[model samples]
Target: MSPPTITENFVDFDIPQAGKPCKTWYTIYGDLGTSKYPPLVVLHGGPGMPCNYLKPYGQLASKSLIPVVLYDSIGCGNSTLLPEKRGDGTFFNIDLHMNELDNLLKGLGIEDEFNLLGHSYGALLGAWYAATRKPQGLRRLILQSGPASLPLWDEAQMDLRYQLPKELQDILDQHEASNTTDSPEYKEVVAEFTRRHVCRIEPAPKELQETFDAAARDPTVVLTMYGDHEFETNGTLRGWSSINELDKINIPTLIMNGRYDTAQDKVMKPFFDRIPRVRWIQFSESSHTAHLEIERERVMEVVIEFLTEDV
Candidate 1:
């Protein structure tokens, strides 16, 4: 049977730091009230990237009978965008995101029974949440292209940079050193790097491209949380590392990444080694955003199998 119609709504969230009410925009697919499969809450990557690219996750709802939820985190996408929050290290922290996520769950009334699928930065957020809170309701975790340690992530990226053509590498280095990341030359190299490690598809999927475009337009959140680019570590989250804490995530976990993923296997090794009940898979033909690229079908199948195995 086909899944129920998707529903889009907004939840009023109180951001204490902003001292104003911010509404989080979320979309739900399938029948939340009646589905036997545990709802999967998909957390999109980027400290600022919205959930638009994750819209395809609704396929699980229609095909596998799983409910799916996607939302734009605070200061991003359809949620409130606080440009003023940018460049202020003290304002954006891990806890701020955690609290917002907690509020989203409570508001959606799914705090008691839900699964989490976090990609990239979202993976870090979800992993940190699971490690620290150990929420009783969180049944499973899907970490896709997740970096276990920011330092290791930077290291891997630098290695990838070295592999690039010397001319492109020089452009990246020169621009970054001069704080001229906005230059077209810098963006050209960034795109080249993305093609190699972000998504290998000839043309990025529409939704994925849209997300990239949005991040390019207003990179405040990503800039504040992460850095000028993938290889840089000058942001507030530069020192963030969840490697030592992965052991605390006792729930069944699935870790995925493309062979050419920006979050290289070396960076994600700690997750496989430390998470007690973890399954690791590398997509040989894909990259960071494999869900929308070459391994799309296989990735979804594996995710559904993992989520439904014990159900």
Candidate 2:
């Protein structure tokens, strides 16, 4: 079969703080205007990570004839970079991202009808947008490997950390206490944790590696919003929680995670328990990015079935 048609464009986005207009880079797989299904807007993880890692989802356009939209949130990737605003927590809050997503939808003219799928940090953004904005066009929701609350995430991660070897645990504690997360030793330890819970696939996929490189190049957004450490939360989003807001998500939602994901089952349970219409699935052998790991085909099949099934 021929490759799916792909189009790339930048939507002009205005940020009040910048005092000038910025652009949001986005890519579309398949023809949005003529597709029978509502376009699916994908939100990638890492407030700073780009959409490159989630590019695999583009397959939906060819497999299910569903238009797929992927965009880099402001302050990250092919979009506008705000290195000057680094360490400014107020400038890189979740509200900015929500507005960016809203602007991208309107900019694309698909705000009137679309399906939403967000992975990791993107899931948190998607849930907040759906619950608060209640965009009339949003038809379905998918929250993949995302935490329901920052407090819960921290607690779960700490539990996982304690399970690691004593020497590794001591190294993490020493580095965190010294505020030396930038050290190569600390980063290597974090990478070890990531391999076990984030992506178990050895020699990470090229797309996923691109995301890592992007984050390493300019960690402004992640540093301000998420923090220097992966398992800890000492950034702008430290106290954020969406447990109460889940009830507002009235649309059908799918929540999935890996049995070994950093987003533990407890972290994702609130969505399944609170969202009025929701289903949960767990990939036994996968980690955080199940779609790119062992269950790629199964992940695609489950998502297609969820998106296409009647309400």
Candidate 3:
């Protein structure tokens, strides 16, 4: 029950198009700087959401002696906030994140040796990086509730939408059709959907809540990268898919999601079938955020085993 040893800092990241550099906040647990084992770079979901919820993974540093790194990917949390970049879709594309991640790794001097664990959008970013960059040192990868194809995820969400209460569906349809998704009615319906598919917990954990609060305070990146809400992809990231590039990733991979996740089994299946060395596991009782929602210990066990094996 001892507190985790943690170190937090900010690294300067150059955004060429922006013609300047911004600080990307990062935190590390355990002795990654000196450990023989490659550190684990944990990517939080929400091209905009902060990495607060992923804090739970820091326990790995103490329990397994594996260094765990978490960061607020530019524009949210402790990182530089640019409200002016909110509506500029081109400015918040996947490449923006990829570049920032690359810079972060190089700055930490671990670009040559590290494991990647991405959640949701973070996983999408990881897949894109691995398939494209093929970083020489990436030894393993973990995709938690990640979507192989944005279109596939939308289809699954559409299916779930049909099951919502008729009144709720009407509210959603009304707001979406009118381009007034900011309406309270629409938000309420989305919250309902979120409860069932995003995180099943009645009241989300404090850290998770903090991420949401951060997003609310500055939704520029979220709106530009992922639109105003989940279950919908109306931003720059639409049509994104890594399914075709799965074969490019040769490292050991683990695909995980909850049965009730927004990124359901069908959407995740392509990843398992396409990746040469991969394993898939579904948390039946959980939803999107399985690590914090339920089965945290089990997730850690599998993760540590996969990362440490043959290392």
lDDT of each: 0.88, 0.91, 0.87
> Across residues 1-311, which tens digit of lDDT does each residue of candidate 1 receive?
65557999998888778877789889999878888988999988888998888888889998798999999888888888888889887877788888888888999999999999999998988899999989999999999998898889899999999999999988987987899988998988888998999988878888988888888778888889887665867889897899888899999999999999889998889999999999998999998988888779999999999999969
Q: In terms of TM-score, which candidate is stronger, 1 or 2?
A: 2
What is the model-wide C-alpha lDDT for candidate 2? Answer: 0.91
TM-score of 2: 0.97
Error of 2 at 148 (Å): 1.1
| TM-score between candidate 1 and the true structure | 0.96
lDDT (Cα, 0-100) at 116 in candidate 3: 97
What are the runs in model 1 whose C-alpha is more than 4 Å off? 1-4
* TM-scores of all candidate predictions against the true structure: 0.96, 0.97, 0.95
Q: If ranked by lDDT, best first, what sequence of candidates would result?
A: 2, 1, 3
lDDT of 1: 0.88
lDDT of 3: 0.87
Ranking, TM-score, top scorer first:
2, 1, 3
lDDT of 2 by residue, 1-311 (tens): 56789999999998889756789999999998998799999999987889999998999999998899999988889998989998898788888888888899999999999999999989998999999999999999999999889998898898888888999989888988999988899889888998999899989999999999998898899888898666788888898999999999999999999998999988999999999999999999998999999899999999999999873
lDDT of 3 by residue, 202-231 (tens): 788898899999988998888887775556
Tell me how many clashing residue pairs each candidate has: 0, 0, 0
With candidate 2 superimposed using the best TM-score fit, by how many Å does residue 130's alpha carbon deviate from the native?
Answer: 0.8
